[model samples]
Target: MANMYDHAYDLEKAIRESEEFKGLKAAYDTVMNDPSSKEMFENFRNIQLELQQKQMQGQEISEEEVQKAQSVVQVVQQDEQIAKLMEQEQRLNIAINDISRIITKPLEELYGQPEE
Candidate 1:
């Protein structure tokens, strides 16, 4: 089995290679570091990244990949004291997984559910 960090790294690579996430990150960083909007930047970037992850999941990427990429987001946004981002990330992780499972309901029933 892969360690979580290794899994996370792979996910990071996946996200870094994704054009959509990259564009969002560039916009997010701009929104964050701009002196004029520093206060709102963290909140907005967090939400945007959260939405990006959801978008990735809905596009048929692995749920685990989006979630792992999100944890890495914490390290990226730390200077903003936006530790709340970590909590939000975790919650979104759950939401994305739930959504993925919901989308696969037919397959799950056909193949039988895997052990949680």
Candidate 2:
């Protein structure tokens, strides 16, 4: 049964580690990626442990196991990176607005642009 269990681990690891599986997994890992979601991670960790145990055996996996795995993955999604990008965009917008404000300032300030 060791071989069987080994195959089970290998299969789970493969699916978990593969790029294609990751694309498929994005549906369930949103909170897990957040720095403040440690509880969410622990909660998902319990569910994931159950799933892994279910996976470690040759027994058929329940739909609940699959669902839990999907949900955990969703919790850990790469939202932080997206959030950082959004923050950068906001900063850029702010900088652009500041630049525009300066350019549109009183002509006396520019000593020019009093034309056009």
Candidate 3:
């Protein structure tokens, strides 16, 4: 178990050093450093988190909530810095998703194989 935990920490370190994470960090810094983009990005993120939380709680997301998120997204999309930040975020998410899939592959193969 200790060795497994050590390996997990190593994986975390590797992820932090990865290009995807570095790109995300750079884009995030750029967005945060710019006063104009900072507020917009933060609001956009808050709205996104709220919507996600609502869904996770099994509560219905109203049309108004969806529209609010969409409007914020539209506004953010128009800002170059925010757009770049979003692009980097998507790349990082994709990389993390791939890692998650890879980690679960053995379990998936074991449980998902069709019986002969």
Candidate 4:
């Protein structure tokens, strides 16, 4: 029987070659290639990371911080290249989530699904 790790590697390779990955990569490249878009995208990503880190640390997110994050989201949403990149990213994330559910089916079957 083939090793599970080998199958996992194959899945990784397949994902890299998938259309969703290709679309996301292209969108990312377009955003990064332009100076203004690159800066805006990087700044937006930094803010998101900061908020996520704060939440992971169990710190309360201040109202000012929430407003700032919302403001940044509005700005990024208005940016055409960044908007496209975000849409592509969402598509890729959905595809990944679907794959994750499929891969975890065996464990779910063994343990049974949790009550909703």
Candidate 5:
């Protein structure tokens, strides 16, 4: 029988070779290859990380900060290359989330599904 860790490594290899991961990598390369797009993407990512950090620390996000984040989101969404990268990222995230759910099914079965 295959060891669990070996199966996990196999899954990791499979994910790396998956088309969704390839598309994400290509889109990321396209964004990073252009200076303006790369700067914009980096700024957007920074804002997202900042907000996430604040939330994790139980800090309240200010209205101005929210507006700034929204503005950054709009700018990134308008950039064709960044937009494509985001789309590819979303596809990969969905695939990863699905795999996570599948892998956690045994725990769910043991503990039973939580109430909605």
Candidate 6:
């Protein structure tokens, strides 16, 4: 029988082979090859991480914080390569989330739905 580690490795391999992952990698490479796009992408990522950290810490996420992240997203959406990368990343995220849900189904069924 396959162990948990073997299943994990297989999942990783599946993700690496997914079209969404490939598209994301290609889009990332294209952006990294351009100085302006690379800078903008990094800035977007930093702002996103900051907002996420604040949320994780139970801090009140101010309207300004949300606006700041939105502003960066607007700018990112203007760049073709970066926009494509974001789309691909979203697709990959959805796939990963699906996997998470599937893996947790049994536990969730046993314990009932978790609080949002």
Each model's TM-score, in the order given? 0.32, 0.33, 0.88, 0.93, 0.94, 0.87
Candidates' lDDT values, in order?
0.60, 0.58, 0.92, 0.97, 0.96, 0.90
Which structure is stronger by TM-score: 2 or 4?
A: 4
Which portions of model 2 show Cα errors greater than 4 Å? 1-36, 78-116
Worst 10 residues of 5 by lDDT: 107-116
Runs of candidate 4 exceeding 4 Å displacement:
113-116
- Which scores greater on lDDT, model 3 or model 5? 5
Off by over 4 Å in 5: 113-116
- Estimate, for each residue in 1-116, the C-alpha lDDT of model 2 and write its tens digit: 57757876776676567554454345234434555654555665687687677678867887877886886666544445434433444555565576557645776476754567
- Give a tens-digit lDDT track for model 3, residues 9-30: 9999999999989999999999
lDDT of 5 by residue, 59-95 (tens): 9999999999999899789999999999999999999
Q: Which stretch of 10 consecutive residues in model 3 shows the poorest summed lDDT?
A: 1-10
lDDT of 3 at 63: 91
Residue 47 local lDDT, model 1: 61
Question: Under the 3 Å rule for N, CA and C atoms, how many clashes does model 6 have?
Answer: 0
TM-score of 1: 0.32
lDDT ranking of the models: 4, 5, 3, 6, 1, 2
Q: Give lDDT: candidate 1, residue 116.
A: 75
Model 6: CA > 4 A from native: 113-116
Worst 10 residues of 2 by lDDT: 23-32
The worst-scoring run of ten residues by lDDT in candidate 6 lies at 107-116
TM-score head-to-head 1 vs 3, winner: 3
Candidate 3's TM-score = 0.88
